[model samples]
Target: MNQQAISDLITKMADDELVLGHRNSEWTGLGPVMEEDIAFSSMAQDQIGHALALYRIQEEHMGGPDPDAFAFLRPAAEFKCCHLVEMPIGSYDFSLMRHFLFDHAEAVRYESLLQSEFAPLQQLARKLKGELKYHTLHADAWILQLGRAGGESYERMQAALDTCFPLACGIFEPGEADQALINDNIYPGEKVLYERWLDNIYRVLVKASLNMPDPAAITPAYGGRYGQHTPHLQPLLEEMGAVLRLDPAARW
Candidate 1:
């Protein structure tokens, strides 16, 4: 990929990580129990830290904007995070479902990145992979714990998943130029990645005595990768961007 295209791709990915990481952090001290609270909070910290690292490279390549400003100043519509991450955290089940979905997706992403031709990106994957192992484990643990519950609890778990699965699926949406990146061998094949997602998730659900919702009945509320986001992002951006908007002319 050319400099501009590579910069744009990584910038978008970094921005997505930045926003979703912050959103997840909002759950700190609020998870169902101390273990979950700590687990999720730590994952959130890892995510935000990784985003900052990537954003620094984006800043160096793209020029002008610092990582913090780029993260905290963006308008709601400009962010590329999937709707799955921005959806409201209604209950423990909901948040856990979101975690399961994203962690699985990121597992695939980090694994693909581990094979990246770019030395910097490969090193990044190596560093982040350490934390991702726990992230995927924690998410799977909760999925098994909750998905195994009987009766009402089981249905509630399924209900939370039914709401988010479409958004989860959108995480794999391919941009038109993504193939070039794939062909260059800088990125992995989307179809193969997606198949892995399906096989892995199906195996998990079946093991947990759960069933995935029918695809024919599923439809995403928004496609944030394509710039369509939930109404929640507006208030989220306001809280995150308020100070940045005030001091756009000021240096910190």
Candidate 2:
């Protein structure tokens, strides 16, 4: 297996979890209700934990930077997370739709990673798979309820889905390292993962009575894989790394 390809894949996954985890943390004390606040907070912790785990693998096994340095010190252009994760949490509707879309992709990606030739990733994927089950459960329940609940709830959810679908597709943006990873069985590739994600998400949307947009007709929001990002990412990174930057050498 190519170490650079493995590093690329791990860092991208870690960056995605870290960014989205920060966004999810924004919901703490601001959710529609206490239950949701707790749920988002819990999931945020899970995402951050996942990020930390992957970063450690990079550091230990791949001779990359340490977890804290890799996560807290990277510039916006250096991050490999897709544009889908960098968008603001926005409204409850938008956040919920993003959660529904992103987590399903994660579920499929991690499921494929379970068969990875890399043992550490395989182990981590196994643990994360269980946590993601709950995350998807929460996302699916809310989507179904609000999607069919009538009135503004239904309208809001549908709108959010339409807006998020294209951005969500960006999660599968092809990367230079992909063919190598696929060839070595390090991963099944993002294209395959995207297809599985579509199937998984389609089932939930069907249950919610939601419309499936024509994926081919929609232009996927891309470029993040090669370090391109929306304007929202820089501010988020500043906020996430603020305290750590005050004194990088200080032990927390």
Candidate 3:
């Protein structure tokens, strides 16, 4: 197996989790209701925990930097998270739509990773699957409820879906080592994962009476995997790393 490919894959996955986890954390006390507030906070913890685990895999097995230093000290240009996660947690509708789209994508990715040739990733994928299952369930339930509510709520959800779908598609932007990972069975490659993700989300969207934007007509917001990002990312990085930057020696 090509270790570089494995490391690249893991780094991107870890970055995605860490960035989105922070985005989720932004909702800690801001959720529309008490239940949602607790739910987002809990999921934020899960995502950050998942990111820590993946970063440790890189440090322990892939000769990468320390997890804290890597996560908190890396420049924005070095991070590999997709545009979807980097976008601010917008309104509740937008955030919920993003959560529905993103968690399902994560579900498909980890499901495929269960067969990875890399033992560490395969085991981690197994552990993460159960958590992602609930994440998707929470997203699906909210999407269905608001989508069927038939008022401003329904309209807002539809608008949020339209806004989020293209951004969500960016999550599968191919990595540099994708072909190597595919050849060595470290992963199924982004194309296969993208297809599976579409299928997986389509089932739930249909049940929710939501219209998925036609992919053929949508240009996915890409470039993040290659170190290019929306202007939003750098500031997010600054805020995320501020405390650690102030005191690099501080321990959690």
Candidate of highest lDDT: 2
Per-candidate count of clashing residue pairs (backbone under 3 Å): 0, 0, 0
lDDT of each: 0.76, 0.92, 0.92
Candidate 1's TM-score: 0.91
The list of candidate 2 runs beyond 4 A from truth reads none
Which of 1 and 2 is the better model by TM-score? 2
- Angstrom error of the Cα, residue 72, model 3: value is 0.8
| Weakest lDDT window of 10 consecutive positions for candidate 2 | 61-70
Ten contiguous residues with the weakest lDDT in model 3: 243-252
Candidate 2, residue 69: lDDT: 80
For model 2, how does the per-residue alpha-carbon lDDT over 136-233 read when each residue is reduced to its tens digit?
Answer: 99999999999989889988999999999999999999889899999999998988998899999999998898987988899999899899999999
Model 3, 114-204: lDDT tens digits are: 9989999899999988899999999999998988888898889989989999999999998778899999988889999999999988888
Clashing residue pairs in candidate 3 (N, C-alpha, C atoms within 3 angstroms): none
Q: Could you tell me the C-alpha RMSD of candidate 2 in Å?
A: 0.8
Q: Report the lDDT of model 2 for residue 46.
A: 96
The list of candidate 1 runs beyond 4 A from truth reads 61-64, 220-222, 248-252
| Selected candidate, larger lDDT, 2 vs 3 | 2
